[model samples]
Target: MGSPKRGHHHDLYQIEASLKEILSLLSEVEIDHKVLFLNADAGFDSENLRQMLEKEKIISNIKTNLRNNKTAKNYYYFDEELYKRRFNIEKANAWLDSFKALFIR
Candidate 1:
């Protein structure tokens, strides 16, 4: 429910670490579940992270830039209709940001 922290505008490694941490927490909680839907900005795209998720047999539905080289020959199974519906979550964030009090100076 929280976004990964970005310090000095360099957050690639931090985002990866946060994802790993979240996975570990989920495992510790003993939540037996399949199909993890992860939505992330393009910066979170990394081969190592993707391979880790694959090794763990966790399906990830992440948003990424089509032009990124990391997508080369990598087959991701996702429902386009479902993804379109999920776009509302992003829109909600934009709507919330309209209230300047939500921002911390």
Candidate 2:
């Protein structure tokens, strides 16, 4: 994680580097199966990131965040049912937030 700074840090800012790190760790762990999907929020929606995930054979289930360009949504595929499952991840994060001392440096 990056240092706590004065302003907000967008998730997409370091996504490529972070994804590389995660892929390396996954390789080390030897998961024995392919990573099929990457369920993320709108903050992670980007053409570059989608291409990277596609290269790894992982389908991105990120929400549409057009940011003013509505036509961009047509280029991506979003699964509403799969996206709903993302709430579980949020719940886990919320639980972790209760232990902020361990996570927030």
| Top of the candidates by lDDT | 2
In order, what lDDT does every prediction score? 0.64, 0.79
lDDT of 2 by residue, 49-77 (tens): 98899888887899888783477645677
- The pairs that clash in candidate 2 are none
Q: Quote each prediction's TM-score.
A: 0.58, 0.77
lDDT of 1: 0.64
lDDT tens readout by residue for model 1, 12-102: 6565566667777787889643566655555656667677777667665655657676546766665566667667988998799787665
Name every residue pair that clashes in candidate 1. none
RMSD of 2: 3.5
